[model samples]
Target: MNDSENNLKRFGENLARIKKAKKMSYRKIAANCDLEHSDIKRYVDGKINPTLLSLLDLAKGLGIHPKELLDY
Candidate 1:
């Protein structure tokens, strides 16, 4: 994959890792982030990219800095 695509995949992997570590399901995280569960699944699956606002919401829900999600 290209660098940008690789970054997206890495970010998705990181998100999944964090989600699994927290023992949270897509529905639960979606509820916390005020997103749809399908959107969360798409994010984890790397089928879609997240917007900055969505990233911020996810970070807040995950109790992490937005940088952490992008660190990959």
Candidate 2:
């Protein structure tokens, strides 16, 4: 995979890890943000990319810093 693809996959992995660590379900996180559970799922599956605003929303939903999502 290319660098961008690698980064996206790694980001998805990091998101999944943090979500699991916090014991939060996709619905739960989605509810706290402006996203849907399906969208979160796609993100975790590395099937799509989220914008910068979406990143902030995810971080808020997960009760974490936005940088944590990019830690990968």
Candidate 3:
């Protein structure tokens, strides 16, 4: 895979891992981030990537710093 693809895959993996560890559902995260449930699912599944703003929202919803998401 290319760099972007690699980053996305890693990000998705990290996102799923963290979400599961936090015991949060896609719907709960979506509600907290004010995003669609399906959108968060897609992001966690690596079906799509996220923008900086979206990442910030996700990190905020997860009670983490935005850099934590990017650290993946």
Best model per lDDT? 2
In angstroms, how far off is 3's CA in candidate 2? 1.0
Q: Model 3, range 33-67, lDDT digits (tens) per residue?
A: 86788988888878898988899889878888888
Give the runs in model 2 whose Cα sits over 4 Å from its true position: none
Instruction: Give the Å error, residue 37, model 1.
Output: 1.2
Answer with 1 or 2, whichever has the higher TM-score: 2
Q: Could you tell me every candidate's TM-score relative to the true structure? A: 0.89, 0.96, 0.91
Best by TM-score: 2
Structure candidate 1, residue pairs in collision? none
Model 1, residue 22: distance off in Å is 0.6
Sorted by TM-score, highest first, which candidate order results?
2, 3, 1
Model 3 vs. true fold: TM? 0.91
Model 3, residue 1: C-alpha shift (Å): 1.4
Q: Rate the local accuracy (lDDT) of all candidates.
A: 0.85, 0.94, 0.86
In each prediction, how many residue pairs overlap at the backbone (N, C-alpha, C within less than 3 A)? 0, 0, 0
